[model samples]
Target: MDDESWALSPNARKPLPELIEDKIRALITNGTFRAGDRLPTEPELAQKMAVARSSLRTALQRLQLQGVVEVMRGRGWYVRSTDVAERDEPLRFDRRVSDSDLLEVRIALETTAASLAALRASQGELDDIAKLAKLHQAASVNDKDELLRTDEDFHAAVVRASHNELLDQLYRSLVPQLRSYRRNSYSSAEVHVRSANDHNQVSWFLRRRDEAGARAAMTTHLLGLYNDLAAQTGMPVEERAGLTNYALEDEPSWQQNR
Candidate 1:
């Protein structure tokens, strides 16, 4: 226990490292500290969060262990970018800005490709998707990371089984972006649970080779991420195109806003 550990809401039941980890995790998960952004120095963070310097160090070390941040020699610790843990570590952000633009195009392609996949997926592909969805539905707090990775793998698997070499190539090439989106999408347990249910429904329909079912399931599920936001804020779906508004209300981070 440390001086400020007693001040956190989760209580001292969680260790200092875990408390610090929670804070850092909240920042990344809430989009407060995005990729490529530098983390505050140890002392600065310790002061800002009212945590003991030693406790903060422990937290940073734990984050490093999780491959969520790094300590550069002679420099300072920085939040690890990218959705994936270590395997996706080396993916630098120096790539062209077209990557973000291409993401919109990829989303359209992927959404349709998943629909086509519902029509043509093999027994094995269908089985895997169903299995992953089930696991996600049954997942608990302790299994969040596992469920998240399995969910991504299942989606990527669908893209791969679509039988279009060009589509597969394009999708595989976009894994980095996909990973980032996945991370950004699941900042709350409510969202994760909703997505898991939708995935399970999609998987069930795809298994039946119902093209309409699969397409509708996928489109509805994916669009829900933004549609829910728009609806919550009373914004028309079409009007959302040119707006920068997130339109999400009572988000988890808002509770932390000073």
Candidate 2:
């Protein structure tokens, strides 16, 4: 297909750069652009998409950061090879990612992801997130395996909806530790109820595009989990906070809620 075929009508609700990125991602995913295929020049892409050159460049830069494409100094961008883009080697975890550390990082990273997802996620992505959350909530307390998988899917979907490939990559690399933490935290029916409430709040904020609300919901959810683990394991608040660089505000609402 010719570059002109890529022309995109401007969206009043979405940024031009985002629209450009979505189109390019669709092209790559659909096999219209194979690995190692050189993309049209920046000017050509901009003209073809009917977007400003700056917007086109921004979209390309974002894709490059995600390892979706490689930019050759003067040559142009090329689709990244599958072997390189989706390597077989597993990401190595720091030998020391304790439960505390995992929760700490989850609070920091997931809250930000939720915030961005509120701003960037499409309706379809939001639907997927809500569906997973509902599935997790509806699973029988005895059905541990299904509950765990559904919970993971809900969180993973939120990260993907953030539209930041680097964040998605980082979260995925921590899956092993995350799974362990979820297993430890989901022991009580009360905890499950609390989690369902938190996830519902998260989905609500995301649907409304309320960034702060989404961030707060995610933070509250993870902090609640952390507090639960700390209580169950008899770990000190200070020690847990030290693992992920969080401060213990004595009697914080998140901790007090339980």
Candidate 3:
């Protein structure tokens, strides 16, 4: 719970660019800079942050690739969007998710939520869903973290309204892992905006008592997600599969395929 806590490395820490990129990204997401705002001049920023210009430049360049910034002809780099970090998470790079596997995970939860939300959601719960959806549209510093949390809660409210205490309890328990995996897989504003739209639709239909629509909407949304992940097959991992070079005797060859 300590504000200063961080996971320490046992060996050489990650490269300077990666560390700088992470911190800068957190700042951008936290709204230290707004979209279209210019960043500090490279040399001045490097001096102020006590970092090498090379490292800072590398960090800025990485952000540029994610559409987080742009280098103008006469002007320096400017923030393109803060939600870029959501798209830049591990999902795309952490070995592509299989569409089939992703679908199964989604079907297991969202489908059930749809059915339950149609019958049991309270008026107050419906209002809460709307509030969360509105909050998610905000990306300012005070609202950014709340935006993420609210988005998660919007889906969770569906489970609660479903009126199945067991289902609700199960979802509540799995929420953290589900959220982490979902974010880890596709944590970008692109997905975030889509999810917000989906949440609103699901909530709308459920409020209308459109049972089939609610179920169908949630299931369809999840299926589309699975398909998107599937399209990313063969995304490259950073490390090479050279385990054989360090393999101990008696190790099986099957592990080398990675």
Best model number under lDDT: 2
Alpha-carbon lDDT, every model: 0.62, 0.74, 0.61
Q: In candidate 1, what are the lDDT values of residues 140-182, reduced to their tens digit?
A: 6355455555565566656755767567555555555545455
User: Candidates ranked by TM-score, best first?
Assistant: 2, 1, 3
Error of 2 at 209 (Å): 0.3
Q: Which of candidates 2 and 3 is the stronger one according to TM-score?
A: 2
List where candidate 1 sits over 4 angstroms from the true fold: 1-103, 142-144, 227-239, 242-258
Clashing pairs in 3: 86-187, 86-188, 87-187, 87-188, 91-185, 116-162
lDDT of 3 by residue, 120-205 (tens): 78887777666666666554334444444555656665676677855654554444334444555445667767867777787778
* Model 1 TM-score, all chains together: 0.49
TM-score of each: 0.49, 0.61, 0.47
Tell me how far candidate 3 lies from the true structure as C-alpha RMSD in angstroms: 16.9
For model 2, the local distance difference test gives: 0.74
